[model samples]
Target: MEPREFFIEDRLERFRLKAFCNLGESGLGFFRLEEVLGMAGISVSDLLDLPMNDAPNQGSLELRSAIAKLYPGVSPEQVLVTTGTGEALYLAFHMMVKPKTKVALIWPAFQALYEIPKMLGAEIIPVPQEKAFLASTWKEIDANLYILNHPHNPTGKTFPDAEWENLLSWFREKKKLVLFDEHYRFLPGEGSLGKTGVDPNHSFFGTGSFTKCFGVTGLRVGWLVAEESFVQRARSFKDYLTHTVSPISEKIALGLLENKESFLPGIQTRVRNNIAKFTSLWRKLPHTKDFTVPQGGLVGWLMLEPGISSEAYADRLFEKTGVFVLPGSNFEEEGFLRIGFGETEERMAEGLKRWSECTDLI
Candidate 1:
């Protein structure tokens, strides 16, 4: 069987490192190691002393315990630390999906959410938020599993706690498994869609990472939280993959988690400031419509003029101004672009100014 290429990631791989202004990245601006360590009151000498061996396959006990604490009532045994959320997601699909299993997936999501399951031969039914919010979409699909992303990517829409409760109740009643990609769960003021704890009787799984809200992408630390039995099964499957995380990454991640209280406030402040700057610039742009202020996360979505496709606009923008923005087609939709406001104010301003210039050419 052939696998599909990941559209957004592939485009990012081409432009991310080289772009003069990157307004397509999905996470908060990354933190330097010194900044992370400084917040934790750790010195280079402390990091230097950690052994260079591979971390335990299930992750170091301290790291797993720290991750467990993020989800209320979860035990260390219920967590499986992976290389990143990508691995956690991969493991989840591999462990739970069978050929022809019916899957319902949130639409315009991170491609891997549905693409991987589709590759596993699961029959996928798209659940668009507009229809799902209206509660009319669920009646049409008979699915065995449901996948979701919280504080969703591309659109950055979040559901209220009561809505999440009702959605989860519906899944539980149907005896369907639910997978929540909670990568942006801690994005300052975002409401979370994932449950606070592992329910002993429910087949719910949560995937998250230090890369997004924690601004520690280089550490590549992420995890899966589920029932102990499911975690154990995932861990066994992980042995066939990367086997274990890097000991160095585990050590740094532990430091960040331990000092989260000190670092998060500052990161959140920068994110909010950048967002405000982006909003100011967005108002000055021309021929843009259907734009919504992102409720949470770092990205904002906007539709361009009627005749222009997002891919064409993004290409022209990059060609003329060296500013990179993700085409909405990357998320399986067209005529829109995803603009990231996770950079410094100066960078965001320059990118937006460039974006204005490019749109003028359009």
Candidate 2:
């Protein structure tokens, strides 16, 4: 299948070779397999020595039990596990999206949501941040709303609680489908599973990864949550794709989530602390006013000084300062760049310092 080559991924590939601070990383950094081994109450050497193809396929009881602690209502039957949230969403799209269907893509968002649909020849309707639809955009109230209402790559710009209710009501009227990616759902105080498009007929599909909340990237463990039927169909697709997730990875994810109450509190502290440092450095810089602080998520979006294109700024920043941030053009927004505040406070501050110094913006 001819796929639209992901520009961001391509740019990231080249940036890796020359990058220093690597602040553009999306997830909360990574954890070593040995660390995971210890959490699982097992030995690293033994985990490494697992028989090749003999590992269990569906997942282990230890892991499932752990996951159960996270989502008390969500049983193993309800979870469609995969190599990563990427695979989970891939399978969900393949299962739910008809060939040539049109998908509503939220702007300045992850590329995979639209990229995968495009590969299937599905029409991508980008929900332009400039003019987001009213009632028709979501589900409930705006009579002037338009098209099938589904949302992917959430921008954290939803209407308020009452407004959201009206929208949901509007969507229910339209029988819309919302593929919500709560990847950045860093809600205040142990953000709970959101209730955006909770209607079953809404065909709401949610995808998340352990890489974010748990700070475990290499685990390759994430999931797609939907009603039971969707789970079954997606699982069928997953069975044929990568077959199944690693039993070992699932076990580790389970352990972290098993004590999610304990685990997430620490993550919250880290996020708050890092963002504080980033804010301090950002405010100190003369040109920092070009960007706004985000409400949730690890990323901060910034615009360069009026005279500079992000492409040139990013190139010089990396080459001279050994710091890196993905240029906005990669995300299809020129003159803009994305930063992750999930790094060490020192590194986040240092990267900003280097950017200001290298750009000669005292």
Candidate 3:
């Protein structure tokens, strides 16, 4: 069967190298090998002695145990390590979604949330992130599975605490399944940290990676948390894919988790500062309309004048300024653009400045 077109990835692939200032990338700036190793307290020699064999399919005991610490009442057996959050999500959707399966998915999210289920023949019902946690919205739409991207992608809006609790209560009462994509969960926003107290051992599934929040993109390590039965099935399904993570990556991931306390706070601080720089510039740009302030993720939406086409505007901006920002049309929201602030302070400033200078052309 043919796959759905992934607009965001396709656009980036075509224009990434042409742009000198990138405001489209979602992950944080790169970390040097030495800096990363130092943060993990691991030396090059430490990794050399590791055997080049496959790690346990379910992930190493130490790594799984460390991941479990993030969620209250979760056990190592409930976690299945995968290639990345994408793969974890794929496995979850593959197992749970089938022909005509009704899924309530938050809109303008990472495309995989919608595409993968559609590929599996699931009927997707788009729910706006703002209304996702509201009781009124849920009343009109009844679906077997609900997908929520907390500190949501593209927009970064988060569910308020009471609303999250109410939604969880509703899920429990209705016996519905919910899957949370928490890729940005570790990043702190104005008033939210995106942490949830849900127990994944029940009817919930959660997935995340070190890629976004921790700047561990190269490692490609992520995980799925669910009931033990689901974990077992995922692990079995994984055997058809990469089967097991590389011995080296798993060991390094273990090191990062062990020393996260020493580095994560600093990353959070840097991102907040970057966000400030982005907003400061955004406010001064002409022809732009007020947009949503990101509550947590690396990206935020920027609206342009009404009747303007976001994709056309983004194209002109990129051609004139060599600065690339994703159009909201990529996420099925046509009137806005998604700009990422996860670059280093220097790069972010330069990119924003470029956009500011080219306002007349765009």
In model 2, the runs with Cα more than 4 Å from the true position are 16-18, 37-73, 130-159, 186-202, 283-289, 360-362
Report the number of the highest-lDDT candidate: 3
Using TM-score as the measure, the top candidate is 3
Q: Per-residue error at 148 for model 2, in Å?
A: 13
Per-residue C-alpha lDDT of model 2 across residues 227-249, encoded as one tens digit per residue: 77887777677767788677666
Residue-wise lDDT of candidate 1 within 163-194, one digit each (tens)? 66776677777776788787876673533223
Ranking, TM-score, top scorer first:
3, 1, 2
Residue pairs with clashing backbones, model 2: 135-142, 136-145, 139-170, 139-171, 140-167, 140-169, 140-170, 140-171
Clash tally for model 2: 8
Residue 316, candidate 1: alpha-carbon lDDT: 76
Model 3 per-residue lDDT tens digits across residues 220-243 = 899999999999999999999989
Error in Å for residue 170 of model 1: 2.5
Number of clashing pairs per prediction, in order: 0, 8, 0
CA lDDT, candidate 1, residue 180: 76
Clashing pairs in 3: none
Using all chains and alpha carbons, the TM-scores for the candidates as numbered come to 0.93, 0.82, 0.95
